[model samples]
Target chain A: MARAIPTRRRWLLSLLAWAVGLIIFFPILWTVLTSFKTEGEAIAAPPHILFFHWTLENYAEVQQRSNYIEHVTNSVVIALGSTLLALLIGVPAAWAAAFAPTRRTKDLLMWMLSTKMMPPVGVLVPIYLLFRDWGLLDTLTGLTVLMMLVNLPIVVWMLYTYFREIPADILEAARMDGARLFNEIVHVLAPMAAPGIASTMLLNIILAWNEAFWTLNLTAAKAAPLSAFIASYSSPEGLFWAKLSAASTMAIAPILILGWFSQRQLVRGLTFGAVK
Target chain B: MATLHTRSLARLMMAPSVAMLFLWMAVPLGMTLYFSFIRYNLLIPGPRSFVGFSNYYYFVTDPAFVAALVNTLVIIGGTLLITVIGGILLALLLDQPIFGQGIVRLLVISPFFVLPTVAALVWKNMMMNPVYGVFAQIARSLGLAPLDWFASVPLLSITLIVAWQWLPFATLILLTALQSLSEEQREAAEMDGARRFSIFFYIILPHLARAITVVILIETIFLLTVFAEILVTTNGGPGVATTNIAFLVYAQALLQFDVAGASAGGIIAVILANIVAVFLMRMIGRNLEA
Candidate 1:
């Protein structure tokens, strides 16, 4: 433990931190606040810091004009679906790299990571053509597969880091107890690695939810996610501040709530492999 | 026999994922390379003849290509510069024993988790509007004219907004790194009559070198392809001033339907990305080795 700082200095530092943090967070807060205002109040001169009349008209319009429920359903299906799919494939790969090391494991991991480094646009033309030709355009299956591959490397990386932390002696004991390979993984590894896997799944869902590029380009109307729904609010005919805020709030509310609850897990998972 | 069987089974279990990802990465990239070598514009339909390096030659020679490359570097470099320096300051500030630290941390990190589209919309509409924007309000209060950020210094403003969203990411990572530093090391330096600045320079900074690298690496990976933020804010304009390579590629491919040109640009972008990736891989590789 370190020595305690003086009370005055501590108070000053804490206040400064809070101020900076809040300022950075102000835009999102403003968006949420603006969602409740009428369109006139939203763009009022001097920026209406809580003096305006509140209304749910924007939300009503958003729900009515845009099939909000369908988009929400699409977001849930795609985000969770892709995360589940990624984990299904990533777990075995991570398990092998963690417990059954080979000379090629490091190279394999690096190669997978390198694929992530490749700009998504570098292959956009080909992918667009492939999807178009395959008749997979504007389909959840198309976006689902894209998100899975994009998130696969990250899922595997996190799982590998977590799996490495498990003691080999424990697994060796399981084997010595005459547990079969399938049974050992199912009975031992899965339970032990549940927290890590859960965090991985959560992080993947967030990533897939926020992914805008492919969703915007690949799906127009049929399979567009909430990201696309928010983007639709953007128009050349002046800023629709209230309606756009409403749409944004609806789009991000679920994941933002999830993030708020799981902040610690997310922070832990993000920093897990970075330190050691 | 069981041990051998288990090892083989584990290897086989991993094969499907490895194989699929390989195909997923290679097929599109390989086709991009092929398209880059031929006259394959989407508009012109015919037996595409092999035009060795012609598309690449045209892409390089074009003024827009040069401008796009410069803009890409500007955006990435500018954002990195602000985020790295600002993030370190914020991280250090937040690392202090702060009251309401959890709430502060959440607030700082909230931007990173916001969907890019939403972030862009909020910044463009709420914060930067010359008429009703918060920035304009403050400017008017100071008796100054409202500056239309999108019209004047459009690229710079977009870069600032994007940097704001990403700064929290850098700050959080660095804060975690800072928190892990040994307090005894700082106390020992203070005991030796080292100034706060000197202690930070000598003891704290060295510990943060790896974190900074990670922040830079991850930030660069996304910054190179910053599409939605640019698209929503400026749409690469006041006359192609803010158009980055990614947006350029999108325009070429989808908007203009110049597949040959987009393919060439895509190849160029991939090469540029790989250069940064190599540096990041080496750093991560060293860390993994240690």
Candidate 2:
């Protein structure tokens, strides 16, 4: 197993791997390619792969048809807003648990984790009624708050995992060097935890961005993010293939790019650092 | 480290998250519990009264509940079977000495990042459409009939789509775990003259056991609540053919306006999830101690 593989076998394996990878990624590739085609070309028999009249018309038409900018704006706001809020609330809790564990802290951690287990459906009716009665429905603030709460446990869990890896010795050394509380955090802890924090934030933003259930149920015209906005295309529309592709491509593009950068964190974060 | 001041400060820091999560869990849950025991319908409002267990009775007795329950299990089981097995094989492939590893990994992992709504729609319209879809095209090219994915096998179609998204996740975690298996250990196994199949079962699968459990537990929890794919594609049916527990509760509340019945269904779903959650919590708790 340690010896170098024969060149022929390597070539064959590489070819097989590449084939599988392309097959897995074909749907996304097809969508992006279809976005550049005319409606007719999108569904053309013996569909065009690269040889087609490529145009930017669908991108423009999609925005005009759906006010796609509004949805994009909403997606940005909700994803960013919820992520920030989760970090704000999660960091301290995670920090406390990681650094200062009491006998009850384990129980407390367990309790927080249990909250994550409570299926959203179990609480859907009351939350919906509350959103309706309190006039929080279809508002960025409401959705942001809901998203924040929805993601809070995960945020805290991920942060706790990262924070646990940080040795107390470094902070103690910083303290011995006459660093104050704020200075120790800013100068010492932040740098050590920065990558993990960035990963957590990126992952949280992507999750919130693509969140569909509450977004579809809670929003209509006003607060609809791209997730809900794209659902409108589900109903039959005339010659909408290219337009749909364009919309989907835009909906996923930002997150897709962000996701590539966060692949390392995806495993760590989703596995709760179990694999790492 | 355990000084009173630090402990107090720790508690203070932990307060907001705990309090918020407590309120989030309690208020809606309490309200759902209350509603589950009473008669409430948004359509026919006014004069609400207690109707102990009747809502549960009706919700469970509804034929849709049985279908939704079975379909939910199918999705959870089907996706788990596909993703876990497929993931192990893919992880093994990616773990090999291959060129352009990064790009191939990028391609493989891209689907996990796609929005469920977008994935659902793309698969429905472009990949699986009976007329003019890629699969249809492939079928025609092969001189075979085009299979209508949603019309014929809605749940299986949903499972395939969901599995496609989750496969990357399983593959990635398993790969990470695989990479961590030291070369020295593998080389030692080779020196001991273990066969390839024996080496994998004895050394590799055992090493992957924890990671596999991690994938299964997390994926099961998430799969239990698959809503967007069904909502966009089948809207829960060619006659409720694809509705799962989450979608069922959703239909009861939003579509049908049966508040009490939906609350009952929601509670039942919660109960169903707890069975998995118990194992998950234990796993995590063990990890914490470790």
Candidate 3:
């Protein structure tokens, strides 16, 4: 129970909090606002705060000049594809670890997590070379597989944590009722695990959507996701501020919306359940 | 409670993930090790001969390597300092009773969801550009000169962008931990006439110690490999100014096609990260029992 502060002090604190929050959020807000401005307005000497000659020309031109739909499609496919694949492989592993008591289960879980700590650069050369040799470069399937591999540990860890919370008695009760092994999982486990699985899926998709290192190194124009699409603006020729803003807004808006819903899950997932 | 049939089934279920991860970790890492030992260049497609320690020697002795090592440390250390401190303050503020606290948190965490490329490009052109950037506009309004952020302070600028992206993560985690701190303890301290600073220093800070350690360790892992922000913002430099070890290896492998040299650099990065990983794993491992 927090002490009731004086009303004046509470009001002052509220003002301070709102000011800090708005200032921290200003960059993203500015980008979103700039996305609606004209090229000249975007780079205006005195930047337009609110009142501007607003236009959707940048969004229209961004789509026309660069196939925005294709990049969007690529991002969707890669993010969802990798997340689903990770779930497919991660669920059973987590279920086993959560339900079964083995001396090595803890060790195995730690090892899986330690794999994530290996810097991607350590294996960049081989992965790049292998992708090149196997013609996996600039391929959606390749990127999906790579993303799945990188995020698999988190998926398993999150599911394991969630599954651990569920009582073994439920499964035991099901088994006592003559339910077969497959029937036990299908009937009792899946329904109970749906919420956990969904959050895991959401977080992984967000991670894959924003993954830049592999996407940048492996893909060219053909299979480039939004990360690559936005990065295309890095060079000066692609430096139309309004168009860049439009593209950036498009790239981030979906994930940002998704991310809001998964904020709780994100803390649990990223911290490997250490904080929680 | 466990039957033999179920135990075997558990192992079977775990096989795919275990085997896949094993292959994933072993294959590429083994290849990187092998590549590092040989004189391999992508441009020179001939019989590759064993160069043993020469690749390591050259990669280490290169001037760029030293600069990259220093830049990597600076970026990691700088970003960690900013985010952790900023996060603690923000978390404390948010913990107070405030109007529209939910919306405030939503706004604070928004940047963490922005794609790295998008964040970098947004900062590079819209905020940091000398002529027409927001900073320039602010500077001109104050009758001061606009600073060329990338050219003048490439690494620091990148550090700021990365720190902005990560500050929310630290805040969210710290706030979560703060909420769990026992209220009775605080009330007791307050009743004992401890002022805010005394309570904070003796009680709140100590309670937040584990959370802070977790934040530092986790952030260090991600911060060590900050690539896209640097790649998009500076391309590793006005002149190798922002090139961390990750970018250094990338430039060697992709730009120069020096596979052997790049592999050696990759090994060095792995070693450096492993040192940090060892400590982090121990910290997390201890938490498991609790």
For residues A177-251, could you state the per-residue lDDT of candidate 1 as single tens digits? 998777877899999999889889988899899998898889888899998878876675665788888889888
Q: Tens-digit lDDT track for model 3 on A124-233?
A: 99999999999999999999999999999999999998999899999999999999877987789989988998999999999999999999999999999999988888
Q: For model 1, report DockQ.
A: 0.69
Which regions of candidate 1 deviate over 4 angstroms?
Answer: A261-272
lDDT of 2 by residue, A197-226 (tens): 998999999899989989999999999999
lDDT string, candidate 1, B183-211, tens digits:
88888889999999998898999999988
CAPRI verdict (incorrect, acceptable, medium, high) for model 2? high
lDDT of 3 at B207: 92
lDDT of 3 by residue, B216-267 (tens): 9989888889999999889998888899999999999999999999999999
Residue pairs in candidate 1 whose N, alpha carbon or C atoms collide under 3 angstroms: none
Best by TM-score: 3
Contacts from the true interface found in each model, as a fraction, amount to 0.70, 0.82, 0.82
How good is the docking of model 3, as DockQ? 0.85
Predicted complexes: DockQ each: 0.69, 0.82, 0.85
RMSD of 2: 1.4
Ranking by DockQ: 3, 2, 1
Can you give the TM-score per candidate against the true fold?
0.97, 0.98, 0.99
Candidate 3 ranges with C-alpha deviation above 4 Å: none
